[model samples]
Target: MPPSLKPHLNGWYRSLKATSRSGLRVERATNQPLAALRGALGVAIALFGALALSGPAMATSAALGAQMAGMATFQRSYRPRPWLALATALGLAVSTFVGYVASPWPALFLCVVALWSFGAGLAWVGGQTAGILASMTVAVMLVVVSLTESVSQAAQHAGVIAAGGVIQALLVLVWPVNRWGAHREALAEACASMADYARRLRHDPFAPFDPDPLMAAREAAVVTPGQARSRPAELTGVRPLVERMRPAMSALADPRVGAAEEGPERDRARELLAAAADILDMAAHTIRSGVSPKIPERAYAALALPDDGPILHGIARHTALRLIGLLAEVHDALETPPDDDSPRYLPRPGVRELLPLTVVAIRRNWTWRSAVLRHAVRVAVVVTLAEGIGMALPYGHGYWAAMTAMMVMRPDFSQTYSRGVARLAGTVVGVGVASAVMVAARPAPWVCGALAVVAVGGAYLTMRAGYMALSTLVTVYVVFLLSMDGLTLSRTAAERVGMTLLGGLLAFAAYAVWPTWQTVRLPHRLADQISAAGQYAAATLEAFASPGPVTRRAMRDALLDYRAARAALRAADDSAATEPVRHRGLRPSQLSDARAAVAAIGRTSMLIEAHAPTATAPSPGAAAFAGVVRDQLTIAAVAARTGTKVDLTPVRDAYQLWSDSADGTPDEILRDASILTEAVTGLEESLN
Candidate 1:
């Protein structure tokens, strides 16, 4: 398992592992409470300002304050720029007004929804930051419209919503969280994780190979480069650096490389590995700090291997040299003028270009009919149904039902169902906690407001911890916001609980009506990943033979595509695993085999990528061998896609020929080629 997956896996593992035990233990109290504190402060300020500005319009102010506090959740995760923050807030205010304005008229409501849906689709297709802001805005609007009565009231709500956004914008300006900080941190963290992996591999060459850290680092690297729209050149090398490091790590960690009994040479190799880890740490630190460390001569000196030493020793020596090269690459990346010969820069698309692309996305999804469009339609219908159901109930808050549908209803079955369960449970517990506090001690409105602020912070802080914690905090925040508006406490808890349950049930029903089963998608996703892997492998091997500057961009893009497809396959399998046995698609073993093959391809591709750049004259047999491996990969990919039997004899024969011709091939190159051939051949066998 990749360490990246471990974070999620641990939660499930703990639950299953301790089913017969008494109960799970609390590890320790959290030390970093500043984020929570920041959240609370933002809300408190919004409330204070609302009260100061409009004394009589407390309800409007409460709504505005709540919106401001709610935005904290997004801030904590993304820390978007002030421009983006304001844009999202403005969208939120507009949606809230539209929801209210269209509430009394069904035709108007439909029109507004159609418009919102178009814009939402466009924004969703744009990127995560935009998608999140758009989704949250729509949710807020749905809730507002359902809750508010008249056009006048809706207008008031809109004004206050805008005011709240303005206040938050001011907060952003005053305490400007670095927008690109996460990008820097993610790349740094990836390097750090690689360092850790290297350290582990040094002590035990047979240590379980966990690519999760590297996967996460790659994900972060790709994302951060895109985020640097203003200066794409600065992050150009990040992708290549990660790509280069990945193969080196895999090559070094091969159990066969250093399989011999331990000795003084092994210890010396261990020292080199440890030193390589230090270089990785230095690279990570340099990326984050923008200050290059002086590379010591000892770092290179440590990698010296005696002639005709152990095979493992040679492997360690080669791996150490690669790491040293990577270290120098990192230094150049941080230099005043980068010294890299080839940099992987990404160009940001302008709005004009983006609009067309968005249209294309909508059209493609609409024609091919993907989960995105299905989910969009699902949200629209479910929210409407919840609204009508709420209006029918004697003590219903339509906003609650609509908001629940908006928040909980996902396109995928697993997430939709899981979110519904969590939302329902969290609401119940949160309402209960609020009721207990309010009934036991009837706190003043100001005190309730303060509690609301605190809850907002807690919610933001605990979001990643689990849905239950987040829900509890959010519920408290909402109840406190309502309390400030002089809402009756006697039925508040009951109404909240009932409405939440109703909303959850409705969202589930929406999906159940036209569910997008992961079972149906798993095979397709896996095939896509296989095809992408084939492209990447071909590009990498072709680079070795081309002799000119390889089209690194094509290989990089294919790698990204492969990564995305692989992630999707994993997600689909996870969803399917949680479903009833009857609904499962590929068996566990099949999925496992496919994943192993994909990973094996990645390793082989990396091997090719590592050695391709420095080729003078490709070995006489190397190009022919590469061609054979590439053809086998393509055939394997086709087999994976079409579910056909594979034949790899030709590839095997070619590898044998390459291995037999040992006249002029460098030992290191021969070793890498051997590794690549074995990986490719093994991958084909796995698929078969």
Candidate 2:
């Protein structure tokens, strides 16, 4: 109580507040380091166990686990699911059927090329798809077919792996437990990440973050899955499933959550926060029940879903601080945060410049060229490269190293970069662990199968969550598999290490050779996105004015396209080479602009798709509202510059009119329409 202690007490209190605040920023959304490590360990052990069970089990576990882990966040899209799965099965069957008629290599060579070409659509200008199921399918077919002196024997074995994946998928459908397991994992990760982020932000004051509710919501949605099938367009397996929940997921960024700017921005944030909270409830209900989560009439009604109150607030506060911290890290990282506005986590620049491809056109729509013959030559090229390496190196098995690289090499630098990083890390860790195990208790050859099984499990787990871990587990088990034939563990591990390093280096070189990063002109990309956004915004508003599935789909597609293009432009610019990193790209500033524009568009898109609440627009007059919206867009930009933040007040009359037009409740439409109008208005202001 003495005056002498007052100054010290105040300083201590101040320090405590600062620490807690900063802790909210730097740490990621979760603090599951121990769990992550455990997951990694489980992966290692599973993989080791798979190989020990014999090749059939190994193959089954690898493919099955891969499919399961990959499909965690998938939504139930019955549309293309059966078609894709059946088609994939038929393709494998035909390939296997053919392997019985001829030697595996010649046939596999054709298959691999077909696989490569078939997958080429995934590339974004100058990028080539890598490590597709086609490759694995061909590889498994060839390995099984070639294992025996006779051709029919190989087909039978290869069929086992395919059948395994099918059976596993069927089990997933019948009993959603497996699917939910992954959802649980994802949810835990999201929760932990949030907790961790909050903890970290309390320490670092300059972390970069923004209204990243979409991201957090994504994390939440990722954990709340009904597991859909994989699509070629998605880089991550569960993309479609995750995306279907976007409308609901958007609530994670509830305005109550992320709007950190003062004044109207705060109110806008609160509205969104309230909406997001409702959607989050819907999502939770849907995922937990394995059925759809119907939201209440009131958007923020989810706030009443038990005790998510503090957690939701924590998510918002931590994210705000986290952004500030990321800013500091980025400045320290690449010298600066590319440009002022955060350039998003992933970049995609929409380059519509379609170089007339004799190959692509044939592959996409033309049925004639998507065959075995077209594929053979491609496989031959890869084989020749591998063989050439084999001949060049004193080690007869050096070709395996080349094969490893060939397996990973892709057309895009970004993917290649990611693959290389994952492969490199996986190999090193696998080798290290394998070395340690071998040194501690040298196992028998038969026991090597057990090791292989454990390794495969590790690979399965890591393949989705941690690339490096996958590589490591795969590497160790692969070494064990090779050792089954009396090869020394030390030698095998050594070769694996050497092979992985060589593979990564050579694959990266191939990626660099004619690499297409697709962001050569970012301002153009921004212009394209902005232009499309304007049209899309108009279209979306029009759709809202008169809703239809076709318009909604078009809007979603355009929005997706814009975001992808923006990502490309941002990455290209940031990686701004004095000389292009490989050749074609844009300046980093251009990327920044593209990214910012994308975010603005994305925010607006969320509003467009949002479930509206009641009340009406300020004016039902379209022309007058358009002009007002335009002005708001401008003000929004200025607000961003001035740090006043954009206003998201609803268009009152428009909402009531919309309510009258649609069968939905008037109040809901009124509130949502108003919010969307305001967001669009703010966005338009920013864009101009």
Candidate 3:
């Protein structure tokens, strides 16, 4: 090839890569833009109608519709009922009424108390909707208090807000979207994501692994299933399977496993993975179609290995064995259905059960060392201080200060900083646009009402896109909200900007005074993850040895516990990564080791979850070796908990025994056991 042609080709390739990466993000955003838009439009219409009927005196009602639009934070699986809307309305009414009845000092004290209590309640509830409701409710009350100093006015505002909620509820009922359908969609997307990963592995076994698609799917699946008795069992059952497949998929995609020279074995492994991807694709189809696919006979027979091979070749071969096991698990997962007798997703708790559960949640997370508790305290301090300052300043909007404080401050340093920046930038743009509109158009009350509805729609549509977009839309929303009362438009924009800046500064200052750095939390998070993984490993092994109802239940519980622990660790790690250079305590190498250790254990658990070759009879020596591997895993976990290094002689000894077993076991069990032993050793080394 000509030199000039080569340069142009390489440049073209780089451009293509960049374009494709950007395109992927844009595609994901636009994928369901329509549904999001439709939901937004519904809220907008409700708000518009409410404003048209009640005029400026009842403008707060439109805020309810805006809240509902944003509050679609409920789990994807459960259909939100009108009762939730009413519940929100009740909460908002209480916040407004309480704020109005109290003077500044009393209000500050009450606000502090309320923030703490609500934070505890949210911790107990542990759902998306609960957090959203808690935050938004407190924010709206602060806004109301700033807008109206008298109890009578506050009461009127609260009443109208409740009416808006009813209107939003009616809209939801009139054109209901099925939460179960959304669950199915999320699950199907997860399966497709996994399948895509598998396909990539098959084509370029050395390709860089990206877990984002699957992670996003898992996050989306966090919603509780609906209360309806008719909810599909598959909806709840697919979560665990998808999670179990993640590590196995990562194992196959490891570039080290694909570094060997191309040969028959490598070619065969690729074909098997291709076949696995097909099966996963079919499983996704079953999820979507609600029709079971016939489990085909073993697509490829377990490979026969020579007595020995090159180290890399051996590694590649072992990966193939693991992949085969995972494929079988997927196949069986599709063939079998969730238990027929399994109850519908736990019905939404009744009003009677809500407080008790909230109490339980608070108790569970009420420690002085708890991140949630600390965050609650920070919020109380920041908000109360902001409100006091706003009240003292004639030009300040007290509610704006309180609202920004509530919205921006977070438990983690990174999130708090990011939210503060986004909120400030968004406010600047939003206020500027709103100020321009008010000054230039000076529209009638009815036109402002319509614009308010549009703003609500805009807020909903861009909510997930980013904070900047959400902040802009919300600012526009606030503008229209204030216009209804015919407030002085001339200085409104300037005052809002000042208040927002004040609130943002307060949030940052509060955090600086009492920060909860992720690095400080890393030890506990990593320990929890290791402990959970250990429990899961033990339960999985026990279930393999004795496949009984009790063992299965224990395994399932442990799996869920492990998943939660891992999530916590990841969250902390991400926050730590975002810390400024001066604030970082842990080195990149140490963090990498921690991650690798976790992944190693995860792969071990997945291998064990494939049932440990129960059909094959193992020799006594092999059985003992398996026990040693289990013991070593426990030892590694204990060391992780204690934050120490430990000797791995037991694991090394077991590996030697397994390598010299008297009677040959099936390659599947042998390879599985071998992988488990390696994981135990890897974990020990990582911890060291």
- Which candidate has the top score in lDDT? 1
TM-score of each: 0.81, 0.52, 0.77
lDDT of 1 by residue, 1-688 (tens): 8887875566445533342121112223332355446545666776766666664244434444345434543543333445454676677777888777776776677567645744563455545555556667766776566546677877776777666666666765576444445556766777787778778877766444444555655554443233544433434465457557766665555544432346664565566667677777777776676664555566655655446553354555566567667766766665554445444444345556667988887787784347777767777776667766776788745557766766665556666666677777778878888888888988877787777777777775666565666677788878877776677876778788888888888876777667666676666777777777777776775565554555566666777677777777877777665543233344557767777767776766766665555546555576676667666766766676666777877866876787787746556556666665666666666666
Best-matching candidate per TM-score: 1
lDDT of 3 by residue, 1-688 (tens): 9886886567435533442332222111321444455555655655566567765645554565346533543323243556666667677777766766674565564565456434633442355456666677777776665556576777777776666566556665675555456556667777887778778877665444444545555555444333334556555555566666655555544443332436665565566666666767777887777787654444433223334542335445555566666666666656665555544343556657767887787787778787777877778777777776777787645568778888776667766777777788788888888888988999887777677767766675566566667788788877877787787876678788888899988887877678777766776677677667667766665554555677667876877677788777887877666653222333457657866766666656655555333344425655466466556656665665566777878867865776676466545445655666676666666677
True-vs-predicted CA distance for residue 161, candidate 3, Å? 1.5
CA lDDT scores, all candidates in order: 0.64, 0.43, 0.63
Query: Of models 1 and 3, which has the larger lDDT?
Result: 1
Model 2 regions lying over 4 Å from their true place: 1-131, 138-146, 163-176, 180-384, 391-399, 435-442, 488-491, 521-524, 540-587, 590-688
Give candidate 1's whole-model lDDT: 0.64
* Candidate 1 error regions (>4 Å): 1-32, 55-79, 107-131, 146-153, 177-181, 203-243, 252-268, 282-319, 328-353, 367-369, 441-444, 581-585, 618-635, 653-677
Sorted on TM-score, highest at the top, how do the candidates line up? 1, 3, 2
User: Model 3: which ten-residue window has the lowest total lDDT?
Assistant: 22-31
Runs of candidate 3 exceeding 4 Å displacement: 1-55, 61-70, 73-84, 103-128, 147-153, 177-181, 200-269, 282-357, 581-586, 611-643, 650-671
Question: Between prediction 2 and prediction 3, which has the larger TM-score?
Answer: 3
